[model samples]
Target: MTAPDWAESALALLVHRAGGTAAQVGSRFPLYADPDDGRWTTTGRGSWTGGFWAGLLWLRARHRAGLGAADLLAASACTARLAPWARADTATRGLILWYGTALAVADPGADALRARAARAALDAWDPRLGLVPWGAALGGERLRARADGVPGLVPLLTSAGPTGARAAGAHLRRHLELCLPGAGGRPRPSWRYDTTAARWAEDTEPGPGWTRGEAWLLLAVADALLRVGTLEGSPTRPPNDLAEAAEQLLESGEFLTGPLVPPADTRRPAGPPDTSAAAIAAVALRKLALVPAAPWAAACATRSDTVLRHLADTRLTRPTHPAGGRPGGMLLDGCYDPAGHTAPSHELIWGDFFLALALAALRGDVDLTRV
Candidate 1:
């Protein structure tokens, strides 16, 4: 079968396995299955949300590939009601809008879905702040600051059109200019709202313990840069500054382990490294590769491939929940409890979705019709 066929089949199987009806899965409730235990669970909540977007993207691709109106309508409806919370955040709202608009283009009967998506997108936008808030927070201050620059820029660049994208890009560049560390310097992963001090501060004292924080910043920026390239209709010519940032990140290589280890940190075996970070890094590299002449593109792609392979081979790509199971369940290695007090760490939908996306992108299988 073609890639589109494979994606369609995979999506169908995934929706079915989640216990959704064919119409529901194919229509507006793409990722809304309740848990098997009939309880609120976080296992499949994360990336599963993306499934709704993925389903819509897939349907549109299928139509482009010559599917019939009946099939298109079914997919459109499934895309419509999959996530009510799409109205709550800019990222999701943009995704729903993008998908919904595509559906409407293919099947005019999907006007309702398009309207709902538009309303959600409007609600997510914050005119006063000049940027869409991720969610309904007082001023979106917390969300904006927490997201830093990277995530905030994605929707603007990729999902939003040139106007919104340019505006958002300018805002992000200004924010980073003021807040980020000097060139060739490292900033804290993030800052906290120090109510008393009335400003943000590096959460941790100077040290090497901020690997994850750095990873987040690097990955986010790398992704935004890539999106900018794609948005500008110059997929092969990314911004040079963005390219440098990515190269700096790649050069860090803190997460990549050779055979040797520091004597003090010998207790922990660094055989495979953090699967999650590796996954994120793989995606970053792929984005950087959009710029064909990017000096670091080849190396980044090579490293990303290695990391992706390691992640897939290590069972990190396994579904968050087992097959033939009920909804609202966790996968074996799905969740993680940072506090280590309560909450079981089980396989989660969010992690799995990202892993799938990263893997799919790496394999040049980004056409959702295959996923």
Candidate 2:
């Protein structure tokens, strides 16, 4: 089938899957689901992945606007529920707040929440670290930086003001310097601060091979470029050089050349594939394609389409599949913490969000960059 055809089918299945998810999770957020039965392990407080759940609800609401007000009310309530995260001491507020509100059109509540999150993130910024600390709120080192912390924060910070824009630039630049030490290798996804020595050290847990690491950083770069491009070189703009840095990385990243869906960790090639990473990369590529004057636009768009198609055709569960007895539309084979043996092959909430987002983009239901 064609792009629209496949994307439409995928979107329909995902919407159906989301309905079941909403019913199952109720007020909580769905984290990941068992690949066999599509049963989700939920979080009461809308953890790091919670915004994706909220985002998926918004996406469904938009896709089915004509159906009724049920989806819209669900999306709004979920967005409102995320207010508590605005005060939480986590860099993931970027993920939680930005995605949670970006697509919420004409909702002053969402707008206020976005503004609150941007200011909160700005307050969390550290001049010494040049980025927001990964934060102790998540039970990690308070002075650590991770690849996952950078993506939505770029735009989130830029929303605050000129100072926030500069902070946004510095945050992304610092992460790029630490995570991507040089040209042509996997990204070091996390780094810890040596408080006594006042030095930063590469973190071992995520390591260089973590599948989503590169994708997360790449998405941040894409966001930086898109936001800078909008500025057109004003005095209040972020480091103009950031646009250049982002473009270069997008052009040369190895994640683009490897398998569309890579392993959870490159170090363990036989491990479960993280389709979530591929989905994240697909959305990033699509956003990159929208960058003005980006030479790689055509290639990025092509690669994005290929990746999304692969996910829809293979990884996404379907009711009609020969081995399928499970609910359809659940994106399977997403590895969550392969090293910890935690839900190594399951349906990740973020995986489902990005997949649906990509499909929505293909079907002309939403703007890829705006969200």
Candidate 3:
């Protein structure tokens, strides 16, 4: 089959699956679903994953635009549901606010929501810390930095203005300097600030081989690389910092080259693979491919297409059932947390979002660079 043949089918499956998920979850947000029965573990407040649900809805609305207006209305309602997260102190407001609103074009509500999130994030920024501290709104260390805090933030902060651009630059640079070591070393996924010592200490939870950590930080670097020229103020970091960060992440992400899907943690090679990480990396690579004149642009694009194809062939479920039943389109083998044995192999909401996004990009229904 051709690229579009598989991509279109996969996209359709994912969107259909999103419709079923919407019907079942209603107001709640899905985190991960059981691989066997398609039963979801839901959250009332949408947590950090809520935006991905909204994003999938927007994709479905765009995909079925002429079919009916219901999907669009559903997407809008879901975006509105994400409003309260704007005031949450977590740096993941980028994940919640930016993604929750980015794809909804000409939406006044989404526009207002994005603006509100940008300002909230700007206010949350700690100038002394040189970045938005990994916030405590979700219950964790308020002065720590994690790889998950950076991706959606780049665009969210840049939308605020030059000050925000500077903050965005500093945020990415600070995380890169601390989490990723020099000379192409492996990445550490988390760091906490020790006030007594006034320095950053590496957290042991995520370990060195956390697959999602590498993918998340790479996505952030790709975002920065695409917007390199916009950070114009006194410059917390060099302009080339973005490119350097991308290069480091590309070198460190081994799954980008092989296995397509990787273990939840590379430290345990025999563990279940996290298709979510691969999906995220595929989107990031597609974004990187859009960076003009980059030496690796062609390579990134090819690898991205290959990764998406591999997932479509292997991970994405087929749409053989009707919409009312346990419809297909679950992107399985997504390891939420291997150490804690939490949903070690299931269908993740973000996994579904990225897989749908990549397939939509392939079929020309959406722009990978923008969303």
Model 2, position 188: C-alpha lDDT score: 84
lDDT of 1: 0.42
Best-matching candidate per TM-score: 3
Q: How high is each candidate's TM-score? A: 0.59, 0.94, 0.95
Q: How does residue 235 of candidate 1 score in lDDT?
A: 57
What's the best-to-worst order under TM-score? 3, 2, 1
**Which stretch of 10 consecutive residues in model 1 shows the poorest summed lDDT?**
258-267
lDDT of 3 at 312: 88
Q: Which wins on TM-score, candidate 2 or candidate 3?
A: 3
lDDT of 2 by residue, 23-75 (tens): 99999999999988888999998889888998999999988988888888899
By lDDT, is 1 or 3 better? 3
| Per-residue accuracy of model 3 over 1-371 as CA lDDT, tens digit each | 23478788888889888988998899999999998779899999999999999999999988887887788889999999999999998999999888889989558999999999999999999988889988998897899999999989988999999899999989988999898865656799899999999999999988788989999998998888777778654323335667777877888877356578988888899998999999999999999888877777899999999999999899887755555455589999999888899999999999999988888877777876666
